[model samples]
Each structure stands twice: as C-alpha cells, then as structure tokens.
Target: EDQVTQSPEALRLQEGESSSLNCSYTVSGLRGLFWYRQDPGKGPEFLFTLYSAGEEKEKERLKATLTKKESFLHITAPKPEDSATYLCAGREKGGGNKLTFGTGTQLKVEL
Candidate 1:
C-alpha cells in the first residue's frame, strides 16, 4: 500500500521567518510526487510535480525537492500572506491521478 506522513502537523512562524515541512512516503512504485497548497475551505492548489529522485521545483518562496523516500517543501522568508496548509501526495504506479496524500501541514505566519 502507498502511504504518506507529514511532520510538524502545524507550524507557527513570525513574518520573515523561514522553515521547511517534510513529507515522507512509501509506495509500491513511484509515478510522481506532488506538492500543493490549500487555503481554509478551498481546494488544493498545485505547487510542483517531481517525477524522479533528485528532482526539484520552485516558485516564489517555495522550493520542493524529492528523493526516493521523501520530499521537502522549503519556505524561505515567509510572510502573513503565505500562511496556508501545505499538502503532498504520491501517485503510485498504475494509480493514475488518484493520489495517496499525507495529512496537510498547517502553517501560520504571524506579523
């Protein structure tokens, strides 16, 4: 079975503070790993897609990197507007777009 675990279920950061969230997983075979950001009561917004180990993607304050066993979402100098729930999902071989997701890491940026 495919499984995912996200650490530090919740994080509180002061504005301009930086941190990183982790997403660990085990799968039968990896099709892809994906990162997403979700606002309260909203659907997840796609952040990145990592197709293989050593792959990485970045945007703005977010940088996502992948390895065979895990992924990391690095947040650099976060701001109040950056507060949101970050989620990671894995697509196992033959799973298509149906992803096995880790419980999201909720981040609060206080100014």
Candidate 2:
C-alpha cells in the first residue's frame, strides 16, 4: 500500500511571508508525484508533475520539488491570492493510474 503524510495541516501567514509545505510518502514502486492547489469549494488545480528526484517546477510564487521519499512545496512572498489548500499525490509504478494523496495543507495569507 502507498501512504502519504503532510505536515502542518494548516498554516496562517502574513502577506509577503514565506514558508514551505511538506509531503512525505512511502510507496511500493514510485513512478511520479504531483502537486496541486485548491480553493474553497473547488477542485484541485494542477501545479506540477515531478518524475524523479531533483526535479522541480515553478510558477509565480510557488515552487514544487521532488525526491525519492518526499516532496516540498515552497511558497515565496505569498499574497492573499495565494491562500489555498495545497495537495500532493503520488503514482506508483504499475499502479495503473491510481494515485495516493495526502490530506493537504491549508494556507491562509493575510494582508
């Protein structure tokens, strides 16, 4: 079975503050990892897809990085618009499109 754990289940930050969210995972055979951002009452929005350790993706104020056992989402100088729930999911090799996900990290940015 594949499992994912996310730290700091919720976070509150002032505008322009920076922080990082963590996602730890254990899988039978890791194939890829994904990151997403979600708003209240809405589906997740795709942020990045990391296929191997040392891989990274970035957009605006967010950056996603992957490793063998964990992934990190770094938020730099966040704004109120950046407030949202960030999620990470992992796909195992031969799992056939099945992805295991962590609960999520709820981030609130105040001006």
Candidate 3:
C-alpha cells in the first residue's frame, strides 16, 4: 500500500487567494516528510522537510506543518507564479534513501 497520499487532486484559484493542501501518510519509524513543487516539464524543486509531529517550515507564501500521520501545506495569498504541482514524500528509518511520493496536488493560480 502507498504510504503517502495528498488530497484535492486539483485546485484552481485566483491570484491572491489563500488555501491549504493536505497530505496524509502511514509510515513506521517515519524519518521525515518532504515537500516539493514541480512545474510542467520540470523536475521537482525541494521545498521543506518535517522531521516530526508539530514541525513546521515556511518559504514566502508557503508553510508546511506535520503531525504523526499527516502534513499540511498552507498557501497564503498565492500568486500566479505559485501555480504548480505540490508533492509529498516520506522517509522511514532504515528504509533506505528511496521515498514513496504522493500522486501530487495540482494548483493553478490565475490572474
């Protein structure tokens, strides 16, 4: 079974709109939860990493928070440039470097 899952298969928003994206995961000995942003035809750009429940990170208009079995990416007043697919992956202790990724959340911010 997939260890990681993200909700809201797709999202459409106007510039300056705010929203939150959810990521749910089930992992034993979870080492960390990672977030990345991917633009069309481009590789994922690393965003943040959560090491434990209650850990949070922020960059510009994006904020990521984690819990024992879930994570959340909060977007505050997103702009058009923020449009992309957000992906989440999990790393388990002693599970090697390989990570299982979620299907990803597609976000489109229009003018």
What's the number of clashes in each of the models? 0, 0, 0
Q: Deviation in angstroms for 21 in model 1?
A: 0.3
- Least well predicted 10-residue stretch by lDDT in candidate 3: 91-100
Please give, for residues 41-102, the per-residue lDDT of candidate 2 as tens digits: 99999889999899999999999998888999999999999999999998877836888899
Quote the positional error of residue 102 for candidate 1 in Å.
0.7
lDDT of 2: 0.92
By TM-score, how accurate is candidate 3?
A: 0.95
lDDT of each: 0.92, 0.92, 0.92
Off by over 4 Å in 1: none
Decide which is better by lDDT, 2 or 3: 3
The residue ranges of model 2 lying beyond 4 angstroms of the native Cα positions read: none
RMSD of each: 0.9, 0.9, 1.0
Q: All candidates' TM-scores?
A: 0.96, 0.96, 0.95
- CA displacement after TM-score superposition, residue 81 of candidate 1 (Å): 0.8
lDDT of 2 at 7: 86
